[model samples]
Target: MAWVYLIIAGIFEIGWAIALKYTEGFSRPWPTVFFGVSMTLSVWMLALALKTIPVGTGYAIWTGIGAAGTAILGMILFGESHDGWRLFSIALIVIGIVALKISSS
Candidate 1:
């Protein structure tokens, strides 16, 4: 349950991050609203997960997911770099996230 919340929070963290690009410095109303909502949900879910999960472990995993996910989306959606090294770096972050989850369990 707590893991589920944490995963959802991580996803919302990605959502808010991507939406931020569309927000154009908060000048775009719709994207700004989406960013706000997703950010709120992400934080709320993180709070729920933190009720059980250790703060350091949970926060690291959450940010790891966000960072890796947002990077992938940036490449796919915004024509950002898809270099081998960049991909490898994202994979390492994913590996770290998996390791943290396994260690926590």
Candidate 2:
């Protein structure tokens, strides 16, 4: 289903984002390869999702998932701040995403 593809793409968005950090400005060979692969797969899956999903809604959801997930991972994996405001913002994004999905039906 298109939703499935979108979700998978969002997950890969997270992967590539984290992997990007490990790339060390793309100087690291292995992480660079990982970033490239992850980025490619992420985009491909998103495109597949677009076959069934409307471009506007799908794009907003995809980027919302990617941004929120990446921000959360940054706090957990990296030494990014885990402030209340940050968590609250992430929660807002998630809530908005849920609203979008619910309204899309």
Candidate 3:
């Protein structure tokens, strides 16, 4: 289903984002390759998802998932800070994504 594809795309988005952290501004060859492949897959899957899902809703969901997942990963793995404001903002993004899905239905 399109939603499944969207979720997969979101996962790939997470992959690309995390890989980007390891790429060191593309100075590391293997990590940079990983980043490139992950980014390509993410966008490809997102395009596939748009085949069936409404573009606006699908894009919102995809971006929300990417941003939230990447932020959480950054906090946990990359020594990024997680403050109250960050948590609140992520929660708001999640709520908005959910609202979009609901409204689309």
Candidate 4:
């Protein structure tokens, strides 16, 4: 299903983003390779999802979910700063994604 592809794409998006941080501006070999592979998968899945979903709606949902998920992971795993406004903004992103899903139905 397109939703499954979107979920996998989101997961790969996270992996690639984290790997990119470790890539050291592509100066490192292992992380760079990992990032490349994950990024390839992410974009491929996105394209596949587009086969069944509208581009604007699908892209907004995909990116919104990915950004919110990644931000949460960064805050939890990397001890990144998270103040009230950041939390509120991320919550709004979640709500917006939910609204989009609901409207699509």
* Top model number, TM-score: 1
Cα error, residue 90 of model 3, in Å, equals 0.5
User: For residues 25-104, what per-residue lDDT tens digits would candidate 3 score against the true structure?
Assistant: 99999989988898898899999989988998999999999999999999999889899999999999989988988897
After superposing candidate 1 on the true structure, give the runs of residues whose Cα lies further than 4 Å from its correct spot: none
> Which wins on lDDT, candidate 1 or candidate 2?
1
From the highest lDDT down, the ranking of the candidates is: 1, 2, 3, 4
**TM-scores for all candidates?**
0.99, 0.97, 0.94, 0.92
What does the lDDT read for residue 1 in candidate 4?
Answer: 92
Model 3: residues with Cα > 4 Å off, grouped in runs? none
Off by over 4 Å in 2: none
* Tens digits of lDDT, candidate 4, 1-105: 997797788788888888888899999999999999999999999999889878887888888877998898889878987999999999999999888777866
Please provide, for model 2 over 1-105, each residue's C-alpha lDDT reduced to its tens digit, 9 standing for 90 to 100: 999999999999989999999999999999999999989999999999999888988998999999999999998898799899989999999998898888888
Residue-wise C-alpha lDDT for candidate 1, range 1-105, written one tens digit per residue: 999999999999999999999999999999999999999999999999999999999999999999999999999999999999999999999999999999999
Candidate 4 TM-score versus the reference: 0.92
For candidate 1, the 10 contiguous residues with the lowest summed lDDT are 75-84
Show the lowest summed lDDT stretch of 10 residues, model 4: 96-105
RMSD of each: 0.4, 0.7, 1.0, 1.2
